[model samples]
Target: MNRSSYPYVKTPPIFRCLIKKQQQATEELTYKPRRRRRRKVNNSDFYWWGFPIGTGGYVIIRFLLTIDWDFGSFIIFMGAVAIALISGYLLIRSYYRDFKSEPPPEYIVNKEIRKKAIDAKNKIRKRYLSRPLKDKVKKLLKGKVRTLEPLTPSATVGVSEKQFLAVLQKYFGQRVNFPNGVFSIIGTTFEYTPDIVYQDSYTGLTIDIEIDEPYAGKSKEPHHCNDNDKDRNRDDFFLKRNWVVVRFAEEQVVKYPVACAYYLSKVIYQLSGIRYEVPAEKLPSIPTWDSEESTSMARLLHRETYLKEHGLWQIRIS
Candidate 1:
């Protein structure tokens, strides 16, 4: 038998069934359901353009019909314009109500965003509140501690000292060196600590500012012999050391800071070779004893004696 004459083989029944099932699956996949498209709603198209144009048309028609070419016509035109504006506003409101996309549901803010908002609010609050607090701090600091009496008036030494330090920091800035207490002065390590020292950059002069309060303590010993001797010795030590001491009493500084400042400025000017004049109003008044009844009687008696010698005593006495 020739090879060409051999019978052609047919596909198996199982293979034919598999091929039919695949064709059916492909036809089912090709048949897709169409997706419904969302309608596009534009806010400006509906409200800004459409409503205004429609209302404007209505207003123009009404104006042409009612116009009389007089003052009344002008008034009527204005009225129509006003009515059109009101209608346009209502139309815009209605369009927004009917066509506006629903606002997304209210969202709980994230922790970080909420925290940032809180921080911003706190910062604003602090900015306002800090000014008054700073002013209060400045006033408190400007108050002189040395002026306070230990027992007579209520002692505000602690408060005054803190305030004084704050003022010093504010005036001089942070780089200034301040001694901790009186003990720093007496320490043995050759440490140079002045109460209030300012070195002039130009003149190379160091100013040592000292404020003295009246020591009200009563010693059992005599004044000229005991504690007074120690004080005099201290004054001598400072003087011998060539220290320029600017001493002001508690009363002088507390009652008259301007006077204190004037004196201080004068000293600085003199040392620095900078010419300055303190105002007359800023100058401290010379202290004088007020005359009491006891002193007045003594003065009268002395005056009478002088007048009698001049033979003018009787006229004055009468």
Candidate 2:
């Protein structure tokens, strides 16, 4: 009623602060940044600024310190150069925060190439060289060794295994052990034997090479189908024991025996650093087999039809 609010309720300091903050928030919500036009950054200027500070700094430091020019310096210089180049375009990125421009197409392409190269390098390293390759049981006294041994061989050996053994023996020589050579977990009755076992006696590296036939020869029942939980469990068991398991279709082993041997050699080298050279080598692309098609393979074989890479081989289920 026109009275100065009956009594002057001195605004509480917190309330006043809250009101200010709310006003600021409201203003921020409504505010739209106005685009300001500025001269585009020149290519020459950008390039000049792009020189990596780390490399430039290294040069300056070396000059000032009168560091002896030798292999060590060269190595250190290369590292500095790598750091600089990898950090940004041409310059150390952190120092030139003010510079901004759309990277040229060439620069973008080069960047993408570099990223892909790095990813490829990492993939190879992580899978084969670096990272964890396989879980090797360790001895407390000597530390980690990539082997678990005194294997319990499997109960049965398939025909395909014996056939492929001859092929592997050609390349691997005595390194290949004829199978029923599988592993059994300690304190458990579980056991599995691969078709072929390649054990590097010196390094104690073991590889399990298996041939997957779509169905059992006698039973005409589907085996090694994708949905088979037993295969996965068996694989896990061996893998945990630090074994490298390689599976091949029975057809691939029979027809492309030499190629299979060559592939095995390459895999052995990659995993255990053992190298082999095959005289007549021709690697062909083999299609991956899956469970659904394997089921079909089983049905076909039951009808007295040979599977022959039937997981959609050179022909579909007609």
Over 4 Å off in model 1, which ranges? 1-193, 216-227, 275-280, 285-318
Identify the runs in model 2 with alpha carbons over 4 angstroms from their true place.
1-154, 185-188, 280-292, 302-318
For model 2, how many clashes?
3
Span of ten consecutive residues with least summed lDDT in model 2: 1-10
What TM-score would you give candidate 2 relative to the actual structure? Answer: 0.48
lDDT for each candidate structure: 0.41, 0.56
Global CA lDDT computed for model 1: 0.41
For each candidate in turn, give its C-alpha RMSD to the true structure in angstroms.
Answer: 36.8, 29.6
Best by lDDT: 2
Q: Could you tell me every candidate's TM-score relative to the true structure?
A: 0.29, 0.48
